[model samples]
Each structure stands twice: as C-alpha cells, then as structure tokens.
Target: MNAFPPAQALSGRRPAVAVWPWPIALGLLTVFGLLSALLGQHGIWLALSWAALSLPLIVTVICLVRAWSRPSDKGGRS
Candidate 1:
C-alpha cells in the first residue's frame, strides 16, 4: 500500500464557501425567472429566464471541472 497521501490531503485545502450558496442562488434565480416569465414573455423577462436557467448548468460545469482537477487518492477515500 502507498504510505503517502495526495498533496491536497496533506495540505488540507478547502473550498472558501459552503455548498449552500450555489443551491440557494439557483433557487432564487429560478423563482425570479419564473416570476419574470409569468409577468411577460419579452424583454427583460425573457433575458432573466434564460440567464436563470443557465445558472445550474454553469454551476454544474464548474463543479465538475473542479472535481476533475483535484487529485484523488485512488482508493476513493477523498
């Protein structure tokens, strides 16, 4: 077995913020987008809906990239 752990395991690097922010932001965006959509179908409402719908996708991509970049211990411990 390997005696040493990955650099991140030794260094104890962590995300600066908690996981809640993304979901909360996403929820707010969705609500706002829905409200905008309900009120109108053109102008700012359409723009808002598009931006809001894209947020979760953006967050997912960012998280996936981060996970892929981090080194794993190969044993699935991290």
Candidate 2:
C-alpha cells in the first residue's frame, strides 16, 4: 500500500475563475486606440493613447516571462 493517499483525495477541487476579462479589455482598448489614432486628427492624443495601450501589454509580457522562468513543481511531486 502507498504511504500517500490518492492525489484526488488530497485536495478539494474548485471551479476556476474566468481571468480573461483584463486581457480582453486591454486588447479592445489597444484596437480602439490604434483605430482612433489612424482615423482621427489629433497627433498628440494618438501618441498618448498608444502609450497607454502599451502599458498593460508590457506588464502582461513581463509577468509571463517571470512565470516561465520560475521553477515548476513537476519532479517535487511524488
């Protein structure tokens, strides 16, 4: 017999939360900002809008890279 109980019994499972809203909102903002910049007349407004749109994207990329570089718990599990 195994010393450890079955994995399923060790932890209670819960429904996952939907986490795509932020990314979706950011993507929509970027698309709208770019479209406005291309079709509208204000040059400074366009630059500012594009810069604002880039902030979330940059943050997301940094988070993804950090997560990818961190050590996983693969082999540590029995």
Candidate 3:
C-alpha cells in the first residue's frame, strides 16, 4: 500500500460540471436519429439520422476501449 491515498483532482466528490450533459446529449442524439429515420424517407433527414445515430455508438466504443485499456485502481486482495 502507498503511504497516502492516491490524490485525484476531481475525486468523484465534486465534478467541475454537472454529470447530466453527456447522457442528455446522447439521448437527444438517439431520439433525433430515430425520429429522422422514421419521418424522412430520403435526403438530408436520412443523413442526419445516420449521423446522429452513429455519434452515440462511436462515443460508446471510445469509452469502452478506454475503460478496457486502463487497469483498475480499486483492487487489493491478498
């Protein structure tokens, strides 16, 4: 064990900004994508729909990759 607990700048106790933004943004993108796809058959709406839908998936992939690549800091078993 270390002499002192690892210090964190943000430390989960207080965030620099509210946590709702990302989730709300992702949900809005998904809703917009679905609506555009359902309402518009062709043209810009379809493009927008595809783009909107893809953003959340891309973000998810990025987050997952980052999470998987990093080692856990909260494990200690002897």
Candidate 4:
C-alpha cells in the first residue's frame, strides 16, 4: 500500500500556473551567459555574462536551502 497519495491525486484539479516559463527563461539565460563569456570576452559582455551565469546558481542554492530547511514528508521528527 502507498503511504501517501501522489500530489496530482491529492490536488484533483488542474494547476493554473504554466510551468514552462521559468525553466525556459533560465535556459536562455544560461545560453546567453555562455555565448557572451566565450564569444564576447572583453568588456560589458563579460560582466553581463558573469552576472547572468551567477543568477542560475543563486536560484539553485536558494531552492536547495529552502528544501533542506523544510521538514521531511517521511516524518523524521519525533
């Protein structure tokens, strides 16, 4: 038997949010950052590329920290 239901089953409704935008935006930013860093390695392009690259990393760290801080669904706490 399953210990818990899937999130979709629990929700039982379509999500209003469109999921593709953020991921697409992040991917574009990464691509731009890479191309800029490699192809435009001198002035403003380099700086913008660095900034763009760091944003994804910053988002990832923030998400990881938030997920780790949350209590586990498996009930680790007594």
The TM-score leader among the candidates is: 3
> If candidate 3 were superposed on the true structure by all CA atoms, what would the RMSD be?
6.8
Candidates in order, TM-scores: namely: 0.60, 0.52, 0.67, 0.65
lDDT: the better of candidates 1 and 2: 1
Give the residue spans of candidate 2 off by over 4 A: 1-14, 72-78
Kindly report the root-mean-square deviation of model 2 from the true structure over all alpha carbons.
8.3
Q: State how far residue 50 of model 4 sits from its true place (Å).
A: 1.2
Task: Report every candidate's CA lDDT.
Answer: 0.69, 0.63, 0.73, 0.73
Give the lDDT of residue 45 in candidate 4.
94
lDDT of 4: 0.73
| Winner of 2 and 3 under TM-score | 3
Among residues 3 or more apart in sequence or in different chains, the pairs in candidate 3 whose N, CA or C atoms overlap within 3 Å are none
Clashing pairs in 4: none
Error of 3 at 20 (Å): 0.6
Candidate 1 lDDT, 1-78, residue by residue in tens: 123345644566533446676679889988887788788789988898888878878888987776677665353324
